[model samples]
Target: MILEAVVLQVKKGMEAEYEKAFRGASKIISSMNGYISHELQRCMEVEGKYLLLVQWETLEDHTVGFRQSTEYQEWKKRLHHFYDPFPTVEHFEKVYTLES
Candidate 1:
């Protein structure tokens, strides 16, 4: 599986609006091909900061399948404006895991 991660910083005073928009945008991504799951995590220590993690069956599932699709445009419209510097997204593959 491919893991996509991004650290987002929303514009001041726009956190609530951004979260609401993100909720609306989640459906768009979840319906895409190869989508496994995703989470939107808020940072308690830092206001307006968020961590977005998404799992995909393969890198192409996100870099091509989703980013190239028309649905991505809607996703961008819903969430992009809230970012101040614009988050940089990175992908990774699992190397190890431990569970009880």
Candidate 2:
């Protein structure tokens, strides 16, 4: 699977709004092709930082299929304004894992 990792640095006091927007945005992404799962994590040391991990079948499914779709526009509109500075998103592939 392909993993898209998005690190969000929200503006101070915007964390709740960011999470609310993300919950709505997640629904849009979930409907897209090749979507497998999503997980949202918060940084303990940094109060306004979050990590969004999304699993997909392929990179194209995100870069092309989802980003080019109208849903992405809405997603951007809903969530983009909450960031203090735009987040950096990167992709990765599973290399190794240890089961719990």
Reference-based TM-score of each model:
0.98, 0.94
lDDT of 1 at 94: 91
Scored by lDDT, model 1 comes in at 0.97
Candidate 1 global TM-score: 0.98
Most accurate candidate by lDDT: 1
Score residue 71 of candidate 1 by CA lDDT: 100
- Error (Å) of candidate 1 at residue 61 is 0.3
- Tens digits of per-residue lDDT, candidate 1, 1-100, equal 9999999999999999999999999999999999999999999999999999999999999999999999999999899999999899999999999988
Model 1: weakest 10-residue lDDT segment is 16-25
Give the Å error, residue 40, model 2: 0.9
- C-alpha local distance difference test of each model: 0.97, 0.93
Task: Candidate 1: list runs displaced more than 4 Å.
Answer: none
